[model samples]
Target: MDAKQTNGGRRHFLKTGAAAGLALKVGVTAAEPRASTPALPMPEYEKLDALALASAIREGRLTALEALEAAIARAEARSQINAVALRHFDLARENAQRLSRMGRAERAAWAQTAPLAGVPFALKDLGVAMKGTVTTQGCAFFKDAVADHDSTLVQRYRAAGLNIFAKTTTPEFGQTATTESRLFGLTRNPWNLAYSAGGSSGGAAAAVAAGIVPAAHASDGGGSIRIPSSHCGLFGLKPSRGLVPMGPKMLEGWLGLSAQNVISRSVRDSALLLQLTQGPEAGSRTGPQPGALIDAITRPPRRLRIALMEQNPFGAPVHPECLDAVRAAARLCESLGHVVEMAAPKLAIGEMFGSMGIATAAGMLASVRMREKETGRTAREDEFEPLNWRSLQLARGYSAEQAFTARTVFDQAARTVDLFLGEYDLILSPVTAAPAPLLGAMSLDQPYESFVKVAMTASPFTAIFNMTGHPAMSVPLHWNGAGMPIGAQFAAPFGAEATLLALAAQLEQAAPWKDRRPVL
Candidate 1:
């Protein structure tokens, strides 16, 4: 693809930063829509959001089996995107068929009780687990690591009656922003296949964008969910750390820098999903008291102070288009009666990056060591990505004292941001420094320096909230001249998801994005 076509058929260069590199070529699925064999008309189910789908099932307008089949057909038709990591179509069909066989009263009871009942969904092939299914974190070594039991979050999803019919792609251990993995290959953007579907939740974001599912699970450690959402044109939110459960397998994800939720075309789906899944699990940390998140979105938000920061906190250059997106979002907030200021927190970004490096490297070492014990052997070089290998190597040189000191730095950074947030109810920023990079821009096999540069450049704005355990979201408020989606990020204080949701809903009303489907 030419430079123009690669960036959604538009011409521009924003000085590509590097990340873990892509291992494959991106296709033209986005530049030009796919030409597939004209299959029979699918049920009109694909056009509906998750809540609408569930309501249809409950109202006897569609059977669960019929809905699942429609989604399966869409998934099969769009297989060229390489978004699906593991398909559960047959299993889902069987389960839905069983549900269809129930009495009318029973079916209504099931649908009424489960908010997502009969809605087709997918889990990103990372942190969360499903019993008896492969929980491969996009690594060859863990290819055989079948989950023995459902993670707490998965249990909640099941209870909500979401028909999880597939697992979506992620980078190895969700280590980078782009989703291409040596184990699962590349997951390209549905908007423009020549570009990346930002990772490590790229597959889920891509699948949802391609209309295979209305929503899919996504986890953000370092902008995984928001990055993909920004690239794929969806609503993605990362809950405050310690708010969402990560139990049965883990008490915390990436030392509380990670949180899991779903990427959806509609804000209500995301807000409702959080309402369904948010709360503590066994061995989980306490979070803010719960409230009706779905109801919160229905109410108009109070006018509040919002800071608009378009520059990179580390002094890296942000792309002009990305800065434009943030500015546009800020203007929209102003029109909505919110106070918008051009401001950012004063913190030592360099020091924070250094400390994060230490903590991440140590975490990678522990993960590799745990896998080593599981396999009863050390990790073979070929089994791990080069970027992850480098992390392991860097971790080997760090001591426990260094790790503790790094933790203190994170604490300080969080405190600093907390104080800054005291004066402002929200921080508005660009979700990424630029539009989605071309496939192979941040290959996993690339040198360590090139990879980190691209990764950081691509996602400079979203990770600080993760570090601070604050609630953050990427709302699809703008699309660049390239036609590539560029999301504006909004972060609120710890456990302030309701505020974020309310604002998101108001924005969704002012500028609807659900109807903006990609060509794919």
Candidate 2:
């Protein structure tokens, strides 16, 4: 956590800016409008995705400060969604001003090196860390926790020249499928505030959907990125395990059931993010070499054999609207020249779920113990929700043999899915059993059994790939009758993100969801 080690060479770039005066003028609150400056024309700001915004800044059509202010204005306007966990508006403004003040030649050079320079961005308040910033992880136990160093991924984000302005909410330890917690309150969906913004990356999804930022850093332990994207009508990709770094603190999350990526409004932004951050840091256990992910965005994938799965693997009845969404996506893929067939991989649902539960409980228990060690106090039961507290109890009872048995089960599931994918290019299914549910339906405070049932039904398909360590994405392709967005989940073989990105780009072009916006 040495300052020099954490900041590296970027300390001068971040700290030695002439923008301190401008930062003082902008103030610290993200929700405050800049009355001293001319009102920013927002339609243009809302229309451009992250890549387009970065391009404008590079071409001098827009100043980085203007982009940042526009994002701040939107964040203020959409305050009801409660997505902003902690704001660093002063720092963001200073960063923007510094970028705006760069010499033309210097700016041109920066553009070449930092493809996402001057773009405002947010990070989920879980997993990743930012120096001098508090990442509560949506839990009261760590409400005062401040990161001493930037996480490896945060360092990459800064190197890419993304302006890190704010952190988004998540369920405590990202333990639930909805973005509601005792600490951060409810993170409502932009499409409909009555519904939940699917979590634990829900706040990230809501921020992007609300146009606060075009894309936000999100991670998926078990469908966190994709569930929110599906609910919010955005594109989210969970890269294959080890394709995105999770290290410096820990090499893997939840025994490699997790991966870090972005929830983006555009396919290219996600592709570019993966291109920028996909690599091993020191002590990485797996080094999956980066592929041509960004280049794949421009190229249409060849005719693919897609497996269509309609039934929920967990035996929960798939909602009619969800069934309709996947069916429509299958038809669309068929029209796109991909052969579609009714197919699914056989899975031991009970074992897979049981193993996942064990892993999650073990992780939760370890995190609590680590926090206790750091704070010199044991965690109170009141600090955690009922389910997480129950997880701690469950973890205390689990033996090492049981943990290893869980890993065996996960390995078996991965092998089973790998065999299934040997005959197909991708598997297409519903991201969830239903569309975004009403807030409180998946609350962590609910009875453990009820929460488990809801969580299992809410996200059945995405976790399969999580267990298998295969690349998967939730592409926003359909809207239900109630006007909620339903995502069609597409998963590729392990380390086949190129295929997923190419197919996502093709779908984005075929059924453009760019212009779609929630009426806030």
Candidate 3:
């Protein structure tokens, strides 16, 4: 379809379907779609996940170039979503053509060995840096900053034969729960254009949900992956600290709270991506001992001991829909033979929050300084959104002793979680305190205190796992009355991604969400 035709249809779909579906939760009831809408065959690559796409390409029914072109077309068709930060279609075309030229035997061999071979993927603009690409961390200052070499993680992604064709949007410096930046405008939810897609991996989430690709790169340093996955109805796993590399430029992100992974429709795709892209690169300070995540998902998990947190620990008012989603997931687990009981690790809540705040502030400040050094100039007020600028100013004033004490508190909390996990194999909770909020609800232009309040309230559950360095995933098992997805989160103890993936895979089997496509 032409641009005008695509835009008109998108407007109609967003208004008629997304706006109307708000009255009923998505998974609970079906909305009446226009009867006049004709059924069209979905493109072969768009219908297949990464593994399936590779299988088709290897079997000679589809070529790598065909898959790339299909994805590029979908991305172009979904232009109304505003998910892309930058496009690399020309470079991707080059790569796809080269891959297509390989002998049939060579292609088949690579398909069997390289998990994501010939799959088109988008890199989250936050931290999955590509060589010579504009690796903007959702900041205007970094818009012109190009990467001199591939990040260690990016190298691994390329090595797996995934074709990188685009970069997705993120919040400035990835400091917020929402994905709106001064550089890139809003990244809207695919399910409902009026709602958020979650961030700083919002662009990646939107792209995948809109079928631009089966999966895309994402990072979570405070729920960048899971939050967006929750909002967009995709599977997102934040692997344990040290499981994914931070790389040649840095050992850790946000003091090891950040992790790299992908947001995907299928559990096996996420698990396989983790298996292939995980492990420490050279100069790594911390990472878990490598484990077989892909293998673990091949079978159902044993009856497991699970602890369920039904309410927000910080006393934030969780939306009733989020609460209901967790309860339903808990019931599903019970029916599946897993034991679920109300439990949470005893924590010094006030101190942990304070420490988290301090550490977070310090990390943001450090990143800003690093960028200033890179650019060799001070940041202008015009270059940052109000909240980021204020946070940087405040964090700059934090004393070393204060930062150290915050780290100590986080460490203590981690230790407490370790002890708590000794009694349970996994913990279940709501990924966010609420569903995807309206645009500008969590804007960085809000006052600093208000921004923090919104950010913390929207993302209470996921950041704790980041601090504790546990493996956590947001499973899209529920949708609210407004048809917005509210994910149920599951976190396993440190270095136990295998357990989590197996359980996620089993859950996927029990309630298959693969066919649940968005209206827009």
Q: Model 2 segments beyond 4 Å from truth?
A: 1-41
Per-residue accuracy of model 2 over 1-520 as CA lDDT, tens digit each: 3435533422332334322222112112212122222353334666577877787677565678878988888887778999999899999999999999886568879988898899999999988889998888788999888889999999999999999999998999998889999988999998889999999899999999988998999999889999999999999999998988887788888888888999988898899999999988998767567898889888799999999988999776998998998999999999999999999999998888889889988977887788789899999999988788888898999999988998898889889989999999999999999778899999998887777777877768988888888899999888877778899999998889999999998988888787666767
lDDT of 1 by residue, 301-329 (tens): 99989998878987889999888888989
Angstrom error of the Cα, residue 316, model 3: value is 2.7
Misplaced by over 4 Å in model 1 are: 1-43
TM-scores of all candidate predictions against the true structure = 0.91, 0.91, 0.91
lDDT of 3 at 178: 79
Tell me, by lDDT, which candidate is best: 2
Give lDDT per model, in order.
0.82, 0.85, 0.82
Q: What is the overall TM-score of model 3 with all chains considered together?
A: 0.91
Q: lDDT of model 3 at residue 285?
A: 65
Clashes of 2: 0
RMSD of 1: 10.1
Cα displacement (angstroms), candidate 1, residue 313, comes to: 0.7
